[model samples]
Target: MWRCPLGLLLLLSLAGHVALGAKQGRVRRELAPGLHLRGIRDAGGRYCQEQDLCCRGRADDCALPYLGAICYCDLFCNRTVSDCCPDFWDFCLGVPPPFPPIQGCMHGGRIYPVLGTYWDNCNRCWQAGNHSAFWGMTLDEGIRYRLGTIRPSSLVMNMHEIYTVLNPGEVLPTAFEASEKWPNLIHEPLDQGNCAGSWAFSTAAVASDRVSIHSLGHMTPVLSPQNLLSCDTHQQQGCRGGRLDGAWWFLRRRGVVSDHCYPFSGRERDEAGPAPPCMMHSRAMGRGKRQATARCPNSHVNNNDIYQVTPVYRLGSNDKEIMKELMENGPVQALMEVHEDFFLYKGGIYSHTPVSLGRPERYRRHGTHSVKITGWGEETLPDGRTLKYWTAANSWGPAWGERGHFRIVRGVNECDIESFVLGVWGRVGMEDMGHH
Candidate 1:
């Protein structure tokens, strides 16, 4: 008779039987001289089982000859190469085997293990614990909710016939600022909130500056965007979005009131809510002008006079012409393609980046946005390169980029900003100045 080891005898004594469920046809098979094993299958389709093969404590003898290879039945097997038999968990430990090792996450033709992360420029992409991957919000949402200027028709875009004549003998400065030239004349930037009404905001801002500058600081009125949002409804979508041509047309024809007279009510509780009713209206006062017909929305403000501007004209895409127009007049209105990354701008000369180049189409969106170009300057980089930039006023408020203003690459028509530059003259007559 083959003598069982002391450890095997101890295990068999505790089991109270030589085999498991012999009455149910579960018989022990002799594999080696003294080793009797029960039948079970592993992931590799090899037969394995827990007989008296488990090590009592930490012995190297707790292994079985499995298909010409050694498969450990010891507890130490879990800490090493995990070469334990499949039934070692069920028969020895009374538990099911753990799930198979999860495969790595695949993206952009690369495999990333769970919890792996990588940064695509400013955006971070990572794999989650549940074997899934996640990327940040789509660019479409940023364009739809944050920016609101619609692309102008080709006719409007190509209407650059009206150019600002440069002086033959005069020399333009390397850098110039409208606010510095006419202090207290340029209007500070205003917040458009969630409203996509850059059309109204930029129009009103540029008009306000021109009105003040043209009047020699006599009539410094911050024009109301709410007046245009609520009243200028012909082919306009209010907060949803609108065309700059329509905004300029309304400023030239229907006219708008001062912000003090009719404050901005474009910020809705929900972005989809309807704009407030037209609180201020005007009646034709002859000479292609108008006077306020309704009382000022802000009752405290008694100046209900309607502010108007001359017909807007486009400026040539030349940087000198744009600079000359901005310096000679006040700020000029410009249409730019606001890319998804623009919203992350804190400071510096802005330009569209290729960070989202490998991203999906939905993550690389751009929308038209209008802004006021107030000045231009050049910065010397560490690499001895000079960066020319335009200082422009945004409608996102003062707490944002560079105190409600931003600088963008100049001369290259970056984001089509210089592609459709426009300037206007405030309808400041003798009577308008006398009132101030």
Candidate 2:
């Protein structure tokens, strides 16, 4: 029963040696230069004898979950799981660590973990770790504290009446930005400090842009937000917050002096009272002085001339119509409801995303806000999904979000930005002048 042939035994032995030799050869090729492929058991740990490389405990620890326990010196190592293999960190870690924190804006990509959070020092805000743009304040607090200034009773334009109409297939420009048309007109982002006068700041800025564009560069006035915050209290409650419509009406009625005449103090209150008196003293006091007003300290009377917005009206909900208005009229003011996640936006087209798991409640829904819609464009994603975006300017300083501007998902009334968009013609005439 046990009769064996010498030929059969020889064949089996040859096959085993051939298989073992093939594995050894493959390992030799993979080993680094000068490293002899040999079996070794030194103090540190087991060396992969076949590959002539040290197999650190981490590699063996991760072998069962990732590659099999058969360790090799190939590209199968994961930095997250086992440092032995490179470039497999994301694949093995499941949720890997994020990129090292850096300055300014950054796109969320493979390098930056989708689960890590970062802080934006320039704007004094924190961002949830994810693939979305990061802004300092979530939409809610930004609007509530900075933008929710419009009063319902103080609305000057009748919102119920729709003014814009869409002609079917109206071939609009693919992109439109006020800054492009009038580069010198776009003012730097204004800082509201601790006050919630975004309504006043944005309104004044819109007026400034319009005046510059409409006058064909003849009139470029940095209309005063302090004037609106200090004097326009009849409808608005001072820096406590005012409505855009109300601010526009006030500008039309009483008008406002230039920032040249009244410098911005960041704070809305004067030490004397809750509302500060509009200092009519024309002088080169604080920053933001132009050559025209550089030496015009004695020209107080000229600086006091009130600037107004004429024929201010509401924009329609139609996206194209709004874009058309921006192209034709210049920058317009729009109210946006800020979601909680909006505050962490560093850069990129902003959209709402759910709060990351285990994040604080601040990542939840916040409040309403206002911004100047400067331009619009369509962006195609890698997956070929096309998204329209509104290039909106924020009052936050240039250090924040795309040099003081942010792109929000457009067309679908993102954050209700398309709702109640307001446009105005700055009252520019020969009579509007400042004596230096």
Candidate 3:
């Protein structure tokens, strides 16, 4: 009597089949490209074949969509010898690795030449939350709409609403600014993935922005979810799902995080560096590794029932209160992180073939989920000239669409763009002082 994961049953779809093995230890299965499963194995009716994750024989596995491997949480699980895979929640040693800017570029704010137009990452943008990513109107929808349903999916924020507010005449701007750039807004990035701190990330982004403007003073950047997660303070880990005030407390203690490297043992570890410049494979190597499957819910926060959002805002609409804080005080440039899935594009789209997220329902590629409000620009076109609305920022150079620079939208682009800002999970590392 196996029950499907709460979230997966509704939206999860099976992708390529994994080679089944003997019926015994935890079942093993591979996921689509880039979907790394950090805390579980795809044990679909397989048996005693004895496949292992991190092979440490203790904690569960944390599978990410990409990176072609899973992170193992052994030792913490206590059962040194077992057939069961470590549960996502039971195994609790989470962390954030160092992710310095690569090749003199920030994550979502890079200067690149696109369509013969050279765009500057920061030229017309405001850096909100400075280094962390943001959840604008659209992204929030993606999260609420699919958070429980989809894993490893990006939620780009929809900015059509943003435009409506900024330009009352329903006029579009060439670009918008970010909140961090706002005079007195709090510039805190939530301590996420460093410990599954998304709960903290979201809440803090909203709360901090609000409080910072209260008393016309800087927001209470003292939100620290880590304190709440501290087993010492409560029964939770210093790194579970993040929340607004809970995360605010955490960020007040520690700022932002990118949770990038530190290869966990027994998973697809390191790649030979001195790797060639980011060039498409002239000849594909052995079909590179696959994504991770088998997801387990984390129990650190207040529930095993993933913290569902209460109608805080009207579905896709931003809290007018918060938006007021965000808009007037913000126009900040949050990190522009493109998802790893963005690289999974197929042939006609560009030079590469569209790679699958491995699963049928999940997004095909990792695209941008973070957005920034750059400067508003008026363009002269037909119909007495029109204003193009959009934000500017960085996305990994790997993706297409808004991957290289802040993307311009006629307003409400598409799912990828919508999920881009508020699509929840994203990695944000600060830039070197001189780089921006």
Give the top-scoring candidate (TM-score).
1
Per-model TM values vs. the true structure: 0.69, 0.61, 0.30
Winner on lDDT (1 vs 3): 1
* Predictions in order: lDDT: 0.70, 0.58, 0.27
- Quick one: best lDDT, which candidate? 1
lDDT of 1 by residue, 1-436 (tens): 2232331211101101222221222112222211112211223222235356654344455666442234556675554235465556655677765535323445455433222222333211111111001023235655765577889988887775576688799788889999899998998998887677898899999999998998888889999998998888888888888988899899988889899899987665275565788888788988988998888989899999888899889888898888888988889999999976676565677777645566567657789999999999988754556778999999988766788788988988888888888899999888777763
Query: Weakest 10 consecutive residues, lDDT, candidate 2?
Result: 9-18
Worst 10 residues of 1 by lDDT: 125-134
lDDT of 3 by residue, 160-185 (tens): 32322444544322333444445545
Q: How do all the candidates rank in terms of TM-score, highest first?
A: 1, 2, 3
Global fold similarity of model 2 (TM-score):
0.61
lDDT of 3 at 413: 36
Model 1 bad stretches (over 4 Å): 1-138, 269-272
Q: Which of the predicted structures, 1 or 2, would earn the higher TM-score when compared with the native?
A: 1
